[model samples]
Target: MSDQTSMISARGLRKSFVQRSRKGPGIEFEAVRGIDVDVRRGVAFGFLGPNGAGKSSTMRMICCVSPVSGGELRIFGLDPATHGPEIRSRIGVCPQEDTLDNELNVWENLYVYGRYFGLPRDVVRDRIDELLDFVQLTEKAQAKVDDLSGGMKRRLTIARSLINKPEILILDEPTTGLDPQARHVIWDRLFRLKQQGVTLVLTTHYMDEAEQLADRLVVMDKGVIVAEGSPRELIEQYSTREVAEIRFGVGENEALAPKVEDLAERVEVLPDRLLLYTDDGERALQDVLGRGLRPETTLVRRATLEDVFLRLTGRSLAD
Candidate 1:
C-alpha cells in the first residue's frame, strides 16, 4: 500500500468568514489562510495554536461541519464539499464545547446519537453498553448529564462520538477543564485508542497535550502555519535540546535580555523570566555565571514543544 492513499489530505485550504457591517466599515476575517496537511491511518495528528489561530476552523472543515471558501480538503480521498455526508459517516467528532443532550443520561446519550446516525436499535444498544465501559463511565450510565462532573461529562461526550465505531476521530480541546487526574484518565484512554490504531486528529491550545498525543503536528499563528513536524523534530530544529529559564530579582527580564541575547542559540525575554536556548544547557549556565549574571531563580530543563512554540510565536500557547 502506497502512502498517498492517506486518510486525510488537505492542500492550500483557505477559509474566510464575512462580517456584516452595522454602521462603519466592517471587514472579512480570514480564520484559515492557505495551508496543507495530511494524516495517515493509524496515526494521531494535532493542530496546536493559540485561540482564534484557526485550529477549530480547520477541524470543522475536516469534519464537514463548516465549509472552506477555497483550496482543497479530502477525507479518505473524498472531497469534503462534494461528499460531506459520506465523509462525516466515516468520522466521529468531539466539538470544543460539550454538546451532550442535557435531557439524556450517559448511556442514553450514546444510544440516541447512534440511532440518529440510523444505526439499528440492537447495534446502538450494544455500542452504548460497550462505549460506556470503554470510557469508564459504566457506573454513571443512568445518571443525568447535569449530575455528572466536568470530567465525567467530557468522557461521556467522547463516548457518544464513538458509537458508530468511526474510522477517524476528531477532538477539539479534549481536556480543557479537567483536573490533573481527570486529564490523565482521558489521556490514558486516548493512548489505548492509539494502540488500537485509531486515526486521531485533535486541536488543542495546550502544547503539552500536543506533545503527548501527536505523532505529527502543525503549529498555526495569525491564521497561517508557522511550523509542522513531529514533536521532537520541531523542537530539535526550531529550539535547543535544553533550555534555561532565569528570573531576575530587581529588573525586568528585558533589562538583561540584550546582554544574554547571544549567549544561547535563541533567547526570548518576557516579563517574568528570560529563556536561554542551547544544545548544552550546563555550558550556557556556566557562561552566564562566569559573566557575573545573577538570577533569583533558575531552572534548566529539556527542550519541549512549548519552548519551540514560544520561539516561533511571540505568544504563549495557553494564553
Candidate 2:
C-alpha cells in the first residue's frame, strides 16, 4: 500500500527483553520475533492471540512506549526512535488495564487527561463535555470513578483516549472482563468510531470480538504470526462452512471418533465434544445417526474464526 494509505508499517520488527537469572548472568528473552505488518488508514486491524503471544509487546512498540530491539517500525511514515513524541501526540492508547484515578470524579478524570495533553483549559472543558455525551456518561459526570461499573469505567477510558482527537486509536483487550451487555455496548461505541473513519488497532483473544470488529487480522502464537487475513477469508481457507458439535456420554467422545471419521472432512475429539468439519452439518449428523450411534446432544452451526484458530493452532482461542 502507498504511504498515504498506511497508518503503520513494520518490516522484520523484533523486540527483546533482558532478564536477570537468580544465580547467573542476565538472559535475553525475545518477545516479538521478526514480523511484518501493514496497518492501513481508516480500518480496524486486530491481533488475535492467546496470552504470552506477544500481542502486548507489539502494541507497546507501536505506541512508542517501548523501544524496538531490531528491524524497522514507522508510524505515519515517521521513525519512532527519533519521532516518539510526535508520533504519540497524534495517537491515543487504551492499555490493557484501566488507569483511571479512582479518587477523581468521572469528569475530573477526563479533564485531567486532556490537560496532560497540553490542551487549553477552555478546549479541555468543551472536549470533556462532548466526550461524556459520546460515551453515554453524562449522567455520571459528577460521580466518583470508583462508583462506576466496569462498563462505565471502560467507557470513560475510551473517552479519555479521544480527548486529543487522535488520528489512530490502539486498544489492548478492550473488553477483557466485561459482562455480555457491557461488551455489546463497547462494541457499538467502537463501531461508531470506525464509521467516523478512525484507524483502530486492537488486540483480543475473543474470536467473536475479532470477527465482529476486525476488517483484517493476524493470528499470533509464540511471538510469531501464524496466519493473517480477513475474518471470512481465514474461516474459508482454514475451516469448513459448518461445524457439527456432537456430545456423547462422559468419556465416550474419543471412542466414538473412529466410528464417524468418514462423516466429515475432519474430526476433532475434545474432552466433552466431537467436532465434525463439513460443508453439510445436517447430512453429517444424519450419517452419524444412521450408523446406530446416538449422541446426547448435537448442534450444527456456521463455522467461525474460533474454528479457524483451533485448526491452525491445535488449541482453543480462549486458551
User: Which sections of candidate 2 miss by over 4 Å?
Assistant: 1-4
Question: Residue-wise lDDT of candidate 2 within 89-186, one digit each (tens)?
Answer: 89999989999999999999999899988989999999999999999999999999999999999999999999999989999999999999999999
Inter-residue clash pairs, candidate 2: none
**So what's the TM-score on candidate 2?**
0.97
Per-residue accuracy of model 1 over 1-319 as CA lDDT, tens digit each: 1144599988899889988799987788999999989898988998999999999889989999898898988899998889998988889888889999899887778887998788999989888888889999999989999999999998888888888888899999999988989998998988888888788999988888999999999999878999999999999888889998888975667888888888898888877899999888888888888889998888889988888788888777877
TM-score of each model, paired residue for residue: 0.96, 0.97
Q: Which numbered prediction scores highest in TM-score against the true structure?
A: 2
Q: Poorest 10 consecutive residues of model 2 by lDDT?
A: 1-10
Top of the candidates by lDDT: 2
Candidate 1, residue 32: CA error in Å? 0.4
lDDT of each: 0.88, 0.94
